[model samples]
Target: MTSPGGAAGTRTDPTGTPHPDPTWGPLYRAGAWSALLFVLLVLVPVVLVVVAPLPPTRGAALLEYIAQHRVVYLTELVSFVGLAVPAMVVFAAVAVALKGVDQSIAAIGGLFGVASEVIALALGSSPQSLHGGLVVLSNAYRAADATDRPALASAAEALIAATNAVSWAGILTAAAILLLSLPMRRASFFGPVLSTLGVLAGAAGIVSEALRPVIGSGYMLYGLLLPIWFAIVGWKLLHVSTARAS
Candidate 1:
């Protein structure tokens, strides 16, 4: 059998191949931090804004709520827009870290992950558009007569629905990262547990997202585990990489 790649003093298998090196600690750490940022900056804000009582489902209630909470909606829109940059960094870091183990899988998986995120961001609401829509709604709510309110409410619903459509992209990104775990299972840098968890979590996550419309939000339980898994894997990668360097 061929040896895994590693540092000068690293032990080799019976065939005299060194283990794969975890020399990419910095990249892993960066990936971890970026992933955490996605949780904090993008995910958290989304959850808060969505789960909040900013608007009830009824038409007049929703209009009144948006009029009262325009700032909150504006802030959430800005947060979503800002997510694109950190998301790119997170995917790129993951790809580089994976490259340290297996290059081909990393390239393909990483490219797909980044592409998924980009597509989601592109197809989703833009900050300016969201902000503009909110401005129009707020102004219309304040100035429009009772007869005009229905059109404004319809516009608001359309905007919210458009934003919600991007949820699939998040699932696709998770699936792409999990694909790299297939190689991680065999690589010396990461063993069976991480890879196994990656696959399970990824699969569950994909299912959760796919069934979300049907389940009516129950899938978030599985969805929430995704970031936690990422954080754990990232932490392990950082530790192992630093250890290898020493």
Candidate 2:
């Protein structure tokens, strides 16, 4: 059942050593199911971040979005648990077939990211980072009203710093593992370069979050890099796995 491409799956590395593919390989990306999930992973946060930058004339909308965040994040939790969580288990079920390096590492990344995400959520952004910085930013009206209370703003900024630190730890660890496994030719290629970007982005985000007074977008944006890159890696993995399978 080996594919025609000389079994890149079985092909030895430059050192002439064979690396076996995983049992189940990459998931069959039939439609855009994986892509949709990827979008969901990235898009929800994007929406949340966008909403944050918006004025609070839309308090109702912001609240709605927060509610939506619960839904999306909860869904994310379930999916990660159901689909992504047990990836590490070396089970004997009919699963985990043909899992190559790409699938293996990408799966690891997803699970890592998800675990971190859930943790960050459990802590609550405000409690971790600036208290209600997101809320304040999202509601321009609130921000405008609170302009006189610089102390609240400082407290909020402090909160952002704290929360983002935790968030970045997860992301940075995940990125390191995923990217290092890629073994790409160039440093700028998608899979190979993504981890680097993830590391830098995650670091920058942490720094920015920690030093709110210095003023830089912290976790506010570090997240943006992982989803798009990691998502694409997830999608690309199937193709790679499929090609190997064929």
Candidate 3:
């Protein structure tokens, strides 16, 4: 059958739906795998946190907790920070896939998604996690004299406060997802269900992040919805790739 673009050698599925352009095969595959990877990375820290709750936010308690639970602490750090890596790929792929529906919105969404990942990775810590700088301070706090201990502890507290403060990275991420969902609603491949989920997840993320200071732990809603959305998106993308391959 002829492609919509009247191109030669265009493959069609059993139901006569034309396969996506072969040029996009690699990107689809990459996005599929990365989306799954993002889910795994997110789950690791979440499970670890449930198994071993994070230490108190106080500088002294936090330092001691990290010292005692070094392995768990470090694992969480790796997982939370690593999320940005796969997320960037997924965002790029989704943007390209939906660009046909609305190029301007797609570009804006992709930009927000990319910028969020870059900012998060650059920060090297999330609101609930400690920065790498605090790890160094923890070691120093342990080794310092009594007088020095207070100063070091104070410094650690300052770092924690700064890291936990609300930032634009998360807001942009939510905006990206919300904007992308708008285009997805117009794309047959994504359809209404995925688009609806994206809208919920994005709205939840925005509300949770924005009100986190006032509504502690409410952000869990966004956290839970995000992985679910990613999982579905990943599976769908994989299906698309497999169809193309067949």
Using lDDT as the measure, the top candidate is 3
Tens-place lDDT per residue, model 1, 121-166, is: 7764542134345556767777998798788878877765564443
Candidate 2 structure quality by residue, lDDT tens digits, 1-246: 332342344434554333334333434332124544645644654465456443222233433343435454343334433332222221111012222334454455445545554554444442122223445443443445555445444544454455444344354334433443343212122244644554555465545544544454445464465455445545544554455422
Model 1 reaches what TM-score against the true structure?
A: 0.74
lDDT value, candidate 1, whole model: 0.63
Alpha-carbon lDDT, every model: 0.63, 0.41, 0.81
Tell me, what's the RMSD of every candidate? 4.7, 9.1, 3.1
User: Of the pair 2 and 3, which is ahead by lDDT?
Assistant: 3
Q: How many Å off is the CA of 26 in candidate 3?
A: 0.7
Per-model TM values vs. the true structure: 0.74, 0.45, 0.90
Question: Residue by residue across 182-219, what tens digits does model 3's lDDT show?
Answer: 87876657888999999999998888877766678788
Descending-lDDT candidate ranking = 3, 1, 2
Poorly placed runs, candidate 1 (over 4 Å) = 1-26, 46-54, 58-60, 78-81, 124-136, 166-168, 244-246
Clashes of each: 3, 20, 0
